[model samples]
Target: MRIAVTSASGKLGASIIKHLIKKIGNQNIVGIARTPEKANHLGVEIRQGDYNNRHDFDKALQGIDAVLLVSGMDDPQKRIQQHRNVIAAAEQNGVKKIVYTSIVGNDSETAFSPVVKSNRQTEKDVQEYGMQWVIGRNGIYIEPDLEYIENYVKEGGIRNCAGDGKCAYTSREELGYAYAQMLLDEGNNGQIYNLVGEAISQAELAALINQVYHTNLTYEAVSVEVYEKERKEALGDFLGTIIAGIYEGINIGANDVHSDFAKAAGRAHKTPLEMVQEIKAQE
Candidate 1:
């Protein structure tokens, strides 16, 4: 049974590929990346793949029995189109199973509405293709918070507009392992798994970080305007808006769904506390 992973050079993709290699051997897996050369180190067959190019994916997915299609990093309309191209190519190439890494939002009118709409459309397209499929709506990754550790330390707290809202933050690395398991397992066709951890609030997160780092950091609930201002001043408007939107999305319960992250892995999923500890250990 041959399998392929798109965007195999990315952090999550590479982690998935590694876990797959351990389970299925490198020879049975194909790592598809925009530049195949960048994925050569993965020790699997490297193929040039692009979500925007049907021909590229058609050629890359050749002889593959199953595939993991990581959603493209683009605006909603463009991303959905790219996903369509990939689905078309996958179907055209006769691939049997597909696992998509989607975000956690089924409603189109949510705070992070655009991505939800695109993912919903993509899910519709995948289902319309009449192939065995699994749509894994992944939770907001907790790993990204590590990037703000220094800032939190400097500011003596975490600032966001997410007032009392909780999020089910997940670890990207473990999520990849679960993906590999799902790909290897049989009879999960047409299932939609909400991959998430326990719902945790920002105040709890701040307290945990303080406990771990031995600092007196607090969680401050600011207005959207103030949060946006601080982020824009620190990281420019584009990234600032994106970052603040994550908190805004959380406030609206975008990532608060009950999920299959633990069931998919057939084990207890890591908690936010464990995830933070793991991050600290790595650092």
Candidate 2:
């Protein structure tokens, strides 16, 4: 089966492309993105197309049997429309199956979770198209912590508003592997998989970071506003604001906890402790 992965420039998308190349051979794979130049190293047939362009998608899906639609990173509003275009094009082109990388608990109205709502709308569109699809409801990735881990170690503490709420953050690589497996193996069509990993609280994460650096570690539960201030000082206004928004959503249970990931992959996922150890061992 010919497989095409959208958003080939992204970390997770690139990983999935690589995995597909190994599973089905490079020649049978296709990579689609707005900027095909960025994905030149993918070693697959690159199709240049924007999510908004239905014409481009028609050409891209010519011989593709399945598509892994990596949700766009643009504004949530635009992403919803773009997803609709892809769904329409896929139906017109007769793509057999589709796998969407969506977010967990997207059907509910949670705190500041625009992606959740947007994904829900897109999922509905896919279902309406009468296509065989699998939704991988991936949780927050643990790799984002790499930016703050050193600072947390240096300050000997980390502050967040999640309090004692637990979160099951998945590794991007693991998620990519799971998506590859899903594409290769059938029987999961129409199933929604909530991908989660080891559960870890902010305090537990602090302890793990401390152990990694052999330093004293602590977690300070603070309000969203206060954390925003600190994050802005460290990460600048724009990015800091975005991170603060995500964490604020976490505090209110938008991303608090879940365990359905193991069910999707049919096995246990990675844990925070293991991730911390790996990070420490790296230079």
Task: Give the Å error, residue 257, model 2.
Answer: 3.9
The local distance difference test score of each candidate is 0.84, 0.79
Model 2 per-residue lDDT tens digits across residues 1-283: 8988998977889989887777788998899989999999889899987998878898888888899999887777899889887888888889988999987642444334666788888877777788788888788887767556777667767777777767778777778778887887787778888877766788887777667767677888988888788878988976676677677766766666666666666667778877667655664
Model 1, 1-283: lDDT tens digits are 9999999999889989999989989989999999888888998899998787888987987898999999888777799889988888889989999989888863653335776788888988888998898888888888766777887888778889988989988887778888998798775667888888899999988887887777788888988778888888989876777677777878877778897876576667787888889888988
> Which runs of model 1 end up more than 4 angstroms from their true locations?
109-111, 232-238
Reference-based TM-score of each model: 0.94, 0.89
Which run of 10 residues does model 2 get worst, by summed lDDT? 104-113
lDDT of 1: 0.84
Supply the TM-score for candidate 1: 0.94
